[model samples]
Target: MTVYRPPARKRLTQDERRAVYERCNGHCAYCGFELETMHQLHVDHVIPMEFYELYEVEGYDLDSMDNFLPACCSCNIYKHTYRLEKFRAAIERMPDVLQRDAATFRHAVRFGMVEIKQHPVVFYFEATGVDVPSLHWDAEIEKKYRTGEQK
Candidate 1:
């Protein structure tokens, strides 16, 4: 998979943003939120930028948007680190692959929706500037615009 680093925003424009949205079908790939509903529009790396920073720090490609994935804020938050074990155990059991899929994690583990209270963790991502998933693991199958399957 090609590695991707977000280029300076100044280097991009509306067309690029639209391209991203179109690539993702203008919906949050993780939570399946409609794009029109959320005013926020931004390209998300399916993998977090931080991870690539680590890889680049160790010497690797730092600019590959191929790994990018579009997502809404809520989905992004849930996917990033929205792990609440007790709560998760309480909800409808998550499928094995879904459990590993970050996109499904938040919807499954964030709020007591699945069961535990994650106010502190949720608030942390909120309080900090971080938002939805912009990247995904390079090895991950990326959404190919036509199929729901990640490839």
Candidate 2:
């Protein structure tokens, strides 16, 4: 029952950005693309900040290090304000998007970094206290990979 909006601050300080890049090992969280090879890389909110504001929840800070992830230009642009599940679903449905970044998507799935759930989507990162119904992914697709059908 909430409308999504883009984050207000589009750029991070050089130090902040550098820290995130180093923390993520210079690789995109969504696509695993190397930052060195890409012309631009973005710092993405793992659990979008829009959700935090919409819900007016407690203890969720979007600017914190725990919530940040390195993302390549393509993935960041495509992701926009969609939640993790919605973004992952887009990767699965779109051939062009998937063809280049399936490995990263699969890796996130394998490691439980991203989850699939229906209805009001919520991705809870325990460390960050991010529990909100703003992100989404398909449980069926997750099952396919978990069962080794898609692997």
Candidate 3:
């Protein structure tokens, strides 16, 4: 039996990493959070490598300096392999999701401990007009899917 393996990802050189870090001036491209330490930063692929097959069709470099962004750990973890617009949509739905799922969140809103503001989901890169690719690699999900755990 052949075991499925994800496509190999390229490791960025020190210079490459530096360039990505400076892309957003040491801030997260998604949330604009200042990253004080390099270790706290994650180099994100604008167009994730998981969609390697789309690179040719999309006419964008799948792996290159032009396709990288500087992201804080929180933003990177949250983005988590979603297309840019999809991530924005997910963020836009946060209030509703919280209200429906989190009792504490709903109680906080009721008591004025939390306020849900209405606004478009505008990312830092988008606000600054810095181009960032919208881009999922989910290993556990893939495994579950292959095993018929996911419908």
| Top candidate when judged by lDDT against the true structure | 3
The candidate that wins on TM-score is: 3
Steric clash count of candidate 1: 20
The Cα RMSD of model 2 versus the native structure comes to 14.0
Number of clashes in every candidate structure? 20, 3, 1
lDDT of 2 by residue, 1-151 (tens): 9866645754677887887777546777666677894336687877666666633334345556666777888888888888776876776666444435788876776798866443432222332343322232234344655888732
Global lDDT of model 2: 0.62
lDDT of each: 0.48, 0.62, 0.76
Where does candidate 2 clash, by residue pair?
A: 85-136, 85-137, 86-136
Residue 84, model 1, lDDT:
29
User: In candidate 2, which residue ranges exceed 4 Å CA deviation?
Assistant: 1-7, 37-39, 54-56, 96-151
The digit string of per-residue lDDT tens for model 1 on 1-151 reads 9866544433446666676676556665544567893356555555445455654543443344454456677656545533323223433244444556666566766654654333322222233333333323222323333356532
The TM-score obtained by model 1 is 0.42
TM-score per candidate, chains pooled: 0.42, 0.54, 0.79
lDDT of each residue in 1-151, candidate 3, tens digit only? 9854436777888888887888888889999999897877798876666676645444455677766789988778877887677778888998999999999999999999999997898889878878654332233345656898733
